[model samples]
Target: MKFLGNKSVASFLQVILTILLCSIIVGMLLQLLFSFWVKNSSNLNFPLQLNNSGLGEFARITTPFPVSYGFYIFFWTLVYTFQVMTAFIIFFAIRVFTFFKNNDPFSYKVVSSIKWIGVITIVMSSLQFLSEVVINIYFNHLDKLENGPIAYVRFNPGLSGIFFGLIILAIAQVFLEATKIKEEQSLTI
Candidate 1:
């Protein structure tokens, strides 16, 4: 509601935020579906006995198409979610910076909050990526036999770079806001 004070900026932020939230929700759902598929796959025998080449080949061949599809969906969802969230944070930092330029009294608090949120989001995203990498490595190692068309997809480094850049921008916004607040305090005195 507070954001609605500035009609244009508020509307823009609302639209972007809505898209980011929806993407995140979809990503989570896709991940859940993938997890279920992995859990229920009978071909992926427990202990993952890599010694038996025939069984390994059979395992790779027998992996359900749906499971692979689910993984693909989850991967893309994650990528989009991260990109959208990063964009949202950058948009917010820009808005806060604009407020600072206008000498708004609340700019400091807003920018600080945005920075903290960006930091938290970045940390959560990093953890999610790490978890995905570990899972991929485990599955790849278990699936030793190259039976069918092996789909090897790499995580987008550009997305990570964007996230890092957003974090830095957020930090800069916070510093700028703090300076604005200091200037305001001096003016008031």
Candidate 2:
């Protein structure tokens, strides 16, 4: 039997989607390997890019725990964990868009995919906040005791991501209700 598919997107869109998916996967792999190599073989500092000038803005190249080893492991694990989650989010989006390209916009699968994306977005933001706190704490501990503790913070105004996730979540709900209505209408005839 022939399967239903989205026809709104042109054939070239599918090709582009495939290219994006492949590149994302490759990039993640390269990052993973690079992280390992740098952490184990070199003192490459992993710059914790933050919107702050002091404390927690930077972590030691591989791990942040220079004095304590546990913090290093914890920080690196957190970094990789979020990296994997981000990769999943990107992959999920590509797949959902592919469904749209095939014209399956109202399908339950697409709605679910969107919901998952929103969930991950919130999760990623939370993880980043936690990471900021951890890095700052580490740096604060390292601050010279005689100099008085440097009061610094890396607060991520995570508004844009949260807003975007909320919007996506709302869109998913709308699409789900629309799908239900369409199904009901079909059954009545």
The number of the candidate with the highest lDDT is 2
lDDT of 2 by residue, 77-188 (tens): 8967876787777667766777766766678888888899998998878777777877777767665542333345556757777788888899889989988988898899
**lDDT agreement with native, every candidate:** 0.57, 0.69
Best by TM-score: 2
Q: In candidate 1, what are the lDDT values of residues 48-99, reduced to their tens digit? A: 2355575554223444422455555565666556655655665565565456
Candidate 2 regions off by >4 Å? 1-14, 40-68, 144-153
**RMSD to truth, every model:** 9.5, 6.4
Provide TM-scores for the models: 0.45, 0.71
Q: Residue 122 in candidate 2 has what lDDT? A: 81
Q: What is the lDDT of residue 166 in candidate 1?
A: 80
lDDT of 2: 0.69
Clashes in model 2: which pairs?
6-102, 6-103, 45-61, 46-61
Clashes of each: 0, 4
